[model samples]
Target: MRLILLGPPGCGKGTQAKLLSRRLDLEHIGTGDLLRAAIRNTTPVGARARPFVDTGNLVPDDLVNELVAERFQRTDRPSRFVMDGYPRTLAQAHAFEQVLAQWKLPVESVILMNVSDAEITRRVTGRWSCPTPNCKATYHVENNPPRVAGVCDECGGRLIQRADDNVDTVRARLKVYHNDTSGLIPYYRQRGLLSEVEGSGSIEQIYASILGILQPQGG
Candidate 1:
């Protein structure tokens, strides 16, 4: 099933998407990751993508649509895909529908991993990442604190909160999410394709909730 994974920042959307992608045998297409990859590669796309990435704003819809369209057409493409971090606004949603209609692959469901704004702030503030450049190894202050304070378990590098992960930046990103992305809730609801999975539980529990929604007939 083609899917859209929806949630605020720190809502466990990406974690749940990764699990569901594996279980359902679908590729996980995270637009944020795509932009980051582009930036890292410094390709023509990256060069053009950098300005938008530096400031936490959604990329232009046309470019995003093209990237997603190209991914969907790959030869070894998954049976379906779980999309993360794309269609941050209603216009992108419209664009996505047009492209999917052209491909004749309308989304089967939109999974919403619901978490509150307060929870989001709490979750992000406590999070830390590996100090290795470009390696974002996330840890938590309360839930998953490192073996040693301010050090990554995997790389032995110091752990630090990402510049974007700080309170001010997280708040800015949250404002953007609330303003632009939340509209898709009603949009998908109108299509009768939205399923909400409570986003307050262990990763496995959350994954199970998502699976139940996706394959409601229980496979």
Candidate 2:
């Protein structure tokens, strides 16, 4: 089913998106990956998008909206896609609504992974990343450590703390998430499309919680 998985950074949106995509047979679309792929493929849009992305800011609305438009237009497209990181702001959400209406599609669900600020800080600040450019596989110092200490199991790359994964930055992100996303909750709820599931359990349990919310009405 078409879904928007919302959460603060490190609230497990990516993991839940993967699970939901597999179970529901929907494409898992992440905005960061979309921009990076566009840049890698050297689309004209990518050339224009690089500077905005390099600064860790949101991509310009025109560029990102066009990309999402392109994505939703592909043939053999599933009826549903789980978007992990698009439509992050009110502008993007408004743009997305226009695009979806033009395409005669409506979002099926807006899913939020509810987590407390303290838990977010605990999970995010403990993350370590592989040094390889664009390889974002993360390890937690306690929950999901590497086979060997301070080394990536996949590529043997050195693991470093992301510049934005520090306590201060994560706290700032949570503040923004709460402040910005609070309104969207009411926006989606009015449409009868919002479903929030606790995301702090085991992966399977969290996935099941989301799946129960998303199952088709009669299926």
In terms of TM-score, the best-performing candidate is 2
> What is the C-alpha lDDT profile of model 2 across 51-100, one tens digit per residue?
88888887776899877776666674446889897777767788888878
The TM-score, computed over Cα atoms with residue i paired to residue i, of candidate 1 is 0.81
lDDT of 1: 0.80
Tens digit of lDDT per residue, candidate 1, span 58-141?
677777776665555556545488888777688889988787786678888888888888888888899888868767788999
Q: What would the TM-score be for candidate 2 when compared with the true structure?
A: 0.81
Candidate 1, 70: how far from true, in Å?
3.5
**Least well predicted 10-residue stretch by lDDT in candidate 1:** 70-79
- TM-scores, one per candidate: 0.81, 0.81
lDDT of each: 0.80, 0.82
